[model samples]
Target: MGNIICSHSLSPLSHSTARCHYLVPTSAYDVFINHRGKDTKQFLASSLYDNLQNRGFRVFLDKSSLRVGQYVPEAITCAIRRAAVHIVILSPNYAESEWCLDELYLLIQTGAPIVPVFWKVRPSEDRMEDENGVYAKDFRKHKKAGKFSTETLEKWRNALRWVSLVEGFISEG
Candidate 1:
């Protein structure tokens, strides 16, 4: 990650270690990291967050950026909207979470720059092939679950397709 300079004017506390002050809805973020908690929250996501923060970038990692009493959905949505760039850590179980897919869809809809990190998963795995593919199987499961509407599922598929086409980093290990 090079010098990630966002257009927003930096707040006085932007480089401070006190992260809670930046959780306000009006605060802008340089980076919004999206990932499955079970997959990469403990290690990869946290490491990336640290790296970005250390480099003086205001980053929003759900676990670290969110306050104890804040509304999760609203906070996440606000952060996504205010973020200059998004780093999606696409792990093996990434497509399994509806929340993750929803975030991905929203991020894409924002038309903001997204840096996809293929962590332990190939870009080919996200290609929504009809017969057999990682994302395809996940969507099939979501369809069978009867919770998500067809349109929503299709949107997720489209998001995956679009993101997979973008040039991104690959982390095989």
Candidate 2:
């Protein structure tokens, strides 16, 4: 190949090794579906998981493996860590659930690529608030109860903002 532009400095690759620096993709479960259990589990998430599984992907879905006595949250965390790619189905009620937010925070922390699929919502309206666009109203409810830490709440907020900005697939339903 001829001289290619250096992605970092916007210069030519004739004398740079930048072009040779390739990122190694993460390995493990081929895909992880992060979605609200009640909102999309029976529909969107399941359909996506089914499609991917049919195509020979090692998919991880929280609903399928939840344990009764064991720590479910920890199990979910482990699944996220083992997933190569994540498909986050962003539904209207996504940000409300504490468990969902926790899973999302972990996904963000992983720094792995996430496929944010908008369901019944758009970026213009994907706002994490208590009484506004895309209301994560549960945050307000949980905050009042004082069950979750301030740091965890903040982390969920930040993660929501990041996910909202990520460009991904969208659906009318």
Candidate 3:
């Protein structure tokens, strides 16, 4: 472990919020948030970001870290590469966004420890659905377009555990 860098001690490159799009880590981060733009409401209220930061994990949100006119793929690739853990906020609309799917692929490739937290946005849905229903169409489209791999089920298992962590204990209260 290295000596703690005071907030003022951070060079611009280490700060995720820098104007030049530098990644200065004053401290190591535990999780990187991969979510839909519209799902920010959940992130905000969950206080997950703030809680993680308070616990000393530097969580990066796209709106604050990404710069305008930058290469979207490159930016995300960099962030995912640097992250120690990735948290996929799997809402109904998450897979619908090409960007989030791209991030998922990159995170998989990068082999970052991922925690997929499914936000149960519906009271009716028992299983995943496609664009024709209450969920995003990506999963179904992929299945119909071609045979899918077992890896997807493995990933979903990880996601289910994440959801259980928050929900199981949450409801116990």
Q: Please tell me which predicted candidate would have the highest lDDT against the true structure.
A: 1
Stretches off by above 4 angstroms in model 2 are 1-27, 65-71, 129-131
Per-residue lDDT over 1-173 for candidate 1, one digit per residue giving the tens place of the 0 to 100 score: 11111112321112122333355544479999999999999999999999999999999998899888876765676687678999999998998887788778878877889999999877878886545866778888988987777776777788888889999999976
**C-alpha TM-scores of all predictions:** 0.84, 0.76, 0.56
Error of 3 at 9 (Å): 41
Model 3 segments beyond 4 Å from truth? 1-28, 41-46, 67-70, 121-133, 136-173
TM-score ranking of the models: 1, 2, 3
Sliding window of 10 residues with minimal summed lDDT for model 2: 4-13
lDDT (CA) for every model shown? Answer: 0.78, 0.68, 0.52
Greater lDDT among 2 and 3 belongs to 2
Lowest summed lDDT window (length 10), candidate 3: 3-12
TM-score of 3: 0.56
Estimate candidate 2's alpha-carbon lDDT, on a 0 to 1 scale.
0.68
Q: How accurate is candidate 3 locally (lDDT)?
A: 0.52
**Model 2, 48: alpha-carbon shift in Å?**
0.4
Tens digit of lDDT per residue, candidate 2, span 52-145?
9899998888776555753554455566666889888888888677667767777777788998998987765555633656645666776787
Q: Order the candidates by lDDT, highest first.
A: 1, 2, 3
